[model samples]
Target: MKLKKNITLGLFISASVTALAWQQSGKPESFAVNGNLSGFNDSIVYLTYGTFDDTKIDSAKVTDGKFTFKGRVEEPVQGMLFSRDYKLRLDLFVDKGAVEVRGATDNLKVAGSAIVNDYALFNQEIMANRKWVNNIFTEAWNAKQSGDTARARLLEADGNKWYAYEYEIRKNYIRQHPSSPISARELLMYVNNKTLDECRPMYEALDAKVKASLQGQELTRRMELLSKIKTGNKALSFAQTAVDGQTITLNTYKGKYVLLEFWASWCGPCRAENPNLRKQMDIFGSKGFNVLGVSLDKTRDPWIKAIEKDGLTWTQVSDLKGWNNEIAVAYGVKAVPANFLIDPSGTIIAQDLRGEALNQKLKEIFK
Candidate 1:
């Protein structure tokens, strides 16, 4: 489940992130990953690492429980190694040195760099939660689709609780290891998970070297793009056809408090927040409060169905371009369930508020 080979080039499917060992770094002529598997019947080993633009994968045939990879890396990069069978995976940093891996398929020992160890530890918790939540959510969704509301609710409750727990774990780790490159990677994984003010200081605290790393540079770009839309700035205006075939423009609601929500039909978290939006809409709909939904959904059927099913009795808009929707792209919304609360004057007051937070914000504003 961890290793997914990209079909295009059979490139290494990112194990996403993994934990503990040692960190080393240098400028050797090349990097080597020599692995030893005790009883893995897999005939090949693979290494995967690269940037967003370039994903590279190398394979080595397993011979007598041993495997080796030889390559050159410009910088110490985060990567993963796994068997051709994908039953075993080790998240580690591949630097310009000889990294040795040994042990069974399940428990792997990686030694090469300090960054790799710390990186693994950070991702071990994060990636584990990602998988856990995703798996449970799939079951819950199946239950919901099969008309099993009770089971679905129970599963969703557990998933939500675990998600919060894992998020807390991430916060603690980043705060404790502000200097770790792993922290940078964690933040970059989902910028919408954090507030600009809260995450900015943490980003600033990263070591100079990390800020220059590929992850760091990308994080920097994401943060910079997000900063332009921070609270207190004027909300950007856009227009799209609402779900009901009515054209909706942000400026048309200029004199009302509006929740500019970026969501998708497929996002469970987004769907879960719809009830809260509805509740707030009822309380404030006549009090100059409104919700403008921008969905990152490409299909009309599921998009309309989700809106009607969720009882979102408010204006919703989309370009049917999914992530490529110009409105969503302009807002730099990588994460769904994202929103910006705008005051009557068209200035964003808060962002990504949900549940009790959204309730409280409307309460304070209306009062």
Candidate 2:
């Protein structure tokens, strides 16, 4: 009886810590965001965040560029602040508290919460340190787009150190500040597409309370899921409603080398890769390769239109639920344009092989 009581108490404390991590909140009933955007007047602004269909959390009318919002959050999560016209966009890290904002669209800032400040500071430092790498990457991208592959490769080689240093810097910060929600947040982001072994050290290094936070719980879930998605692991079988209202099943594609693609209609990059993807499909269609598209589109019209416009001839499926699509959540697909290459035996052999990488992999397999 005593052992069971201890276990229950432990669970209770974990839940309590997650709910009350926002200090100075006194476990407040709700959070308030007060803003002063002196550069504009009589406008509408929005505060939006959440993974599962709660994107638009709150909104307020700005009178003379001043507005106020009152809401509650169970844990720390990033929110988006933007005008109704969508011109001004800024990242706001928020939890329960009185968060204050001041300045114009170009210079807006959030204050009155340590976690929020840390989030801003982390961005500033990362940008400042990564400026050189960013320049090189931008130049490389331009070179590649202009068909200057040689120069693009050269620029990419030059930026390799900065790329590695960025990872090192991130790992250092996460280890040094285990208590910060920013640490937990970045750690979770960094773990994307990584193996369980790669993420376990830092995941274990996080503060106990931080690990018990909502994001922490998500991280745990991701790592657990990661084990089953690694190379040599069997592809997870799934069934979903296709765009044409028919049921689609992964088991039907078991005998072919399949590209299980996750994308969305609103993703510009996903659309940009359509022509190249179509070319690959044409070349490899008879060589035991096929493509399956999984869309994260919320509406039917845009989803269907994008398929027709992009000339995507593959079987596409979606639940018309946007980010709330259960398959996306299952795969931890925070962003789109991701894919997994499954072999004939239903084993996931590779992933995210875009552009030239995808071509090279297919060539090696089909050669």
Residue 37, candidate 2: how far off, in angstroms?
3.7
Badly placed stretches (over 4 Å) of model 2 are 1-28, 49-56, 85-87, 127-170, 195-197, 243-246, 299-302
Predicted candidate 1 versus true structure: per-residue lDDT over 78-197, tens digit per residue? 678876667888788776678888888766777766665555545555566667777778888998999999989988998898677666666566656656566776777646524777
Off by over 4 Å in 1: 1-35, 38-48, 52-74, 80-89, 96-100, 113-183, 190-195, 205-209, 244-247
Model 2 over residues 232-286: C-alpha lDDT tens digits? 7888888899977899888879789999899988999999888888999999998
Q: Give, for candidate 2, the lowest lDDT window spanning 10 residues.
A: 1-10
TM-score of 1: 0.65
